[model samples]
Target: MSETSAGRAPEDAAGPAAPAGPPGAPAATLPYEAIRAIPVRHYGRWAAAVVVVALLGALAYGFSQGKIIWNTVGTKLFDHTVVTGVWHTVLISVCAMAMGLVLGVLFAVMRLSKNPVTGAVAWAYIWFFRGTPVYVQLLMWFNLSLIFQTINLMPFYKNDTVAVMTPFVAALLGLGLNEGAYMAEIVRAGIQSVDPGQTEAAHALGMTGAKTMRRIVLPQAMRVIIPPTGNEFINMLKTSSLVSVVQYSELLRATSDIGISSNAIMEMYFVASVWYLVLTSVFSVGQFYLERRFARGSQRSLPQTPWQKVRTNLTTLRRPKVAR
Candidate 1:
């Protein structure tokens, strides 16, 4: 009995244990299964989209088939006067924008200055220009000869105010000065958007204020500044139509001349609208590309192009199905 008990103890000591895995064998892994994708259907959005498309289609059909005189519009679309007017409009917008850019940047800097007098002066300028209606300002500029018959530049020459303040000149001054007031705010906002550390770092490097602004600050601020400036530019293009009130003979004025003479007012206006639409469309495309160019450094992943988006949608739809 003692011998049998001793043998049983040895067997119990070697009791059953977990089976050993092969040397360095990895543990068994579950087969990979992609997460199931569930597409959300926004019924309200789909209904709204359908309604909008229907409305747009109806409007387009009406415009195309309406009893409007397409012949007159076609004849005047490329008229010499219309083309010349477009040129004049372009010239005015370019010059005014240039003037506005210079004054805007200068006033923006002055507005931000630590000097109370400088800041106050800039503030006053912006306030006055922004407060006044652009039409009234244009009229005031057009009649400046009444206030100052002559502008005396003793060292250079004195010119009659009327001679200097032609319709073109008045238009330029009114648009540019008004635009500068708005642009000042835009530039100031852009500069403020930049991280304050950038300015401190510039100072630490012993850089002058002007140098730092030109090299470090403005470059980075451009990404923010460009979008609004483009919007202002496009708006300026449309606003130049107001110069017609002062007889500057811009696109609208020239088109009006033809309409009145030919007694085809509606047709001429339609022609002018078409041209304006074309110009705005061109600028819109340009603005889009410009924004994309400036956005490259800031975004981690750039927005997908139309084609890329289409391809992505196709791939998503074609994703392989797993057995239920």
Candidate 2:
């Protein structure tokens, strides 16, 4: 339909070909610059800073009251008291955990036994210990010598006087035995979490029950056992405070002594909290890495790195404040 040597529109080009009608799909739109720009967070992050500043101000004002000086928190932290308490805290945690591990395994086996006697004994032990509060156990242990009158550890060392157990020994027994009950359950659960086929396969290989369990089941069980074990250890660290009642010279007790001597209760308490925070932080890091290792056995991908975790935390923090 070209014009025959004239200035007329071509027939096919006329009227713009009826426009590309509404039924046709819309053209893709480009992203706007505004939407493409990343959102910014407001400067609402001063909450922690403000709280810290207020705490500092309080301390300064209180010090101005002349109650805090060289003889108080300064000497308490720098002196031997805090150091001895920290050492005691570590000692108690290590000893208690070791004892718990032994008894935990023993009772775990008992609980898993085919013999009704063994199972019942384990059940009764667990029931009593887990049922009673740990503080009560400590109190009872403190008075156990009163019940026994003259206790005997060795023939030559047998005391003529009423053999009263020291606060240290009482604390150890109370915490260790109580931990054993809970640890037994943890051990049992770990062993059970293993696949039955594993035990069967080991047996089919002519391995004895004890050997198979020791080499195979326990190893797999550790993957489950360790994460909770770490957590329990941390919990036990805190629980060590309960031993203060018995006059153990552990961290909290030391802090208490400092408080009494200095008459600066809050300062000594803060000092205790700082040490606890440090220890707990250390345990927390260990727990996290151990959990990561255990999880990797069944996980599809690598765990997030510390930096990635930090970034994720920052992202959450940067989110807008809102009413709960």
Candidate 3:
């Protein structure tokens, strides 16, 4: 080691090493820029900045209008339909998803069944549900009570010994059953996506067909299934509007009612658009993350993060490559 020439070696001897501070000193003097190196192109950062500016501009313009029509309309929606609409929408989505999943699994098995009767029945179900319009189905379900008069559900709805199906039940069945047809195909495709070797291996390991399906097949298939399932759920929420024809008092029905009663046709529709936009935006974001989670087992690599997705999208837009 070299030292300063107070009574010793010349300082020039220590030249190369002198600037090196103790490790603790460099750590203590952390560079803020290095610590915070957020890339400028990050999606959330740009989106946040854009949203803030847009919101501020809207607020300013709304105040300048003197009438505050946007606020008034916003207050009305919040006071009445928005919250309840969201709840009902979620309830319908959850119920429909559950019912659809069960039906889809059963239908998939039936489609793969050796028994001709079971396969035919499954095919007929898919044909009817997929061929017919969902709106018509909802109408049919609501009117089913007209044909059945009184249902003998044994004990579930046997309060009066003869219970009639309500509009809500009809709507649920309509949306759920119809959704199942589409989900059945998704389920079948997802199941088939797994390697056939996996099934054979499971059998060689003494696993029963059902055991192999449950343990090996379905688990692997989820990566294929979940993304589309999320899409269907979101679609279901939007499509549930058709239930309004049966007067089920869902979001669309309420909006129509308010519009007619309040004589604010255009405005009420605008209000409805706001609700739909909000729901779609929230669900889209959620679906994006859900898709990422499921992508882990996909043949392709794990999905890009939202920022990466945006960057890729922008890059594609610039190049305009045809997707295979």
Candidate 4:
């Protein structure tokens, strides 16, 4: 055969040869082509955002044009009376929450008891308290003196009911007792969420019912209980305003008094709203940390704090992209 034909036959039989590389060098690799991906455009999200911004702008303009006295709001924001009212609000909220927590735990245990009498009693307490409006309860406590003029504890203590049941006391009883009913349900639900096996294991370990509950069950249940309790406490802060009806000089009552005296009623309301926002926001931060503390064993990773979230978002925005 001819030389060209013979060489062509061999090349065809063997298939195409790879391109040669320089001596002592690695084989050449095919060049990489990166894919350019386009992200989806959410026109709906953009439209919603624009609508929200427009609505917010309209609200701001409306408030600006209203007859609200901004000067009065600023002037009274930190007045002695307003500060005192804020103090009272916090004081009452804390006290009431404490009382409610105790009552809730007690009632929850009783409600879960095997004894029929104790369970029935707990059920009735929860039912009645939850059934009634808190406002009505406050009024009832304030006027309790009319039904029973004096409270007698015999050798321990005795006093006129009216004297004993001050506005603060009445408010406390009203808010705390009402809160207990709701908290009992929350606590019960948390307790029920715990595994029955854990309780049985505790029993097998020679722990008494109360010991098992306090040591094993309660500690675990707290993770569930804390979130709702924090929410209840925040709600209690706002609900404390209703105590003003019973003549308790809480934040709302104090603000209203100022409004009446200064004739800047709407402005005073704005001040009260601002203070409420501040107080709730502070408690919300506290609640977040508290929840994080309890989430140690339960979560694979704890949720990011507000500051952490902000930092992560900023970092993402500033990150350098690789050229394709």
The best candidate by TM-score is 4
How high is the lDDT of residue 120 in model 3?
A: 94
In model 2, where is the ten-residue run with the lowest total lDDT?
13-22
* Comparing 2 and 4 on TM-score, the stronger one: 4
Q: Tell me model 1's lDDT, rounded to 2 decimals.
A: 0.88
- Report the alpha-carbon TM-score of model 4 versus the true structure: 0.90
Per-candidate clashes come to 0, 0, 0, 0
How do the residues 166-192 of candidate 4 rate in per-residue lDDT, one tens digit apiece? 999999999999999999999999999
TM-score of 2: 0.73
- For candidate 3, lDDT tens digit of each residue in 218-274? 988988898888888888888988877777777777777777887766566667778
lDDT, residue 31, model 2: 36
Off by over 4 Å in 1: 1-49, 64-67, 305-324
- Worst lDDT run of 10 residues, candidate 4, spans 1-10
* Rank list by lDDT: 4, 1, 2, 3
- Clashing pairs in model 2, backbone N/Cα/C closer than 3 A: none
lDDT of the structure predicted as candidate 4: 0.92
Error of 3 at 300 (Å): 7.1
**Alpha-carbon shift of residue 268 in model 1 (angstroms):** 1.3
Residue pairs that clash (backbone atoms under 3 angstroms), model 3: none
Note each model's CA RMSD in angstroms.
8.5, 9.3, 11.9, 6.1
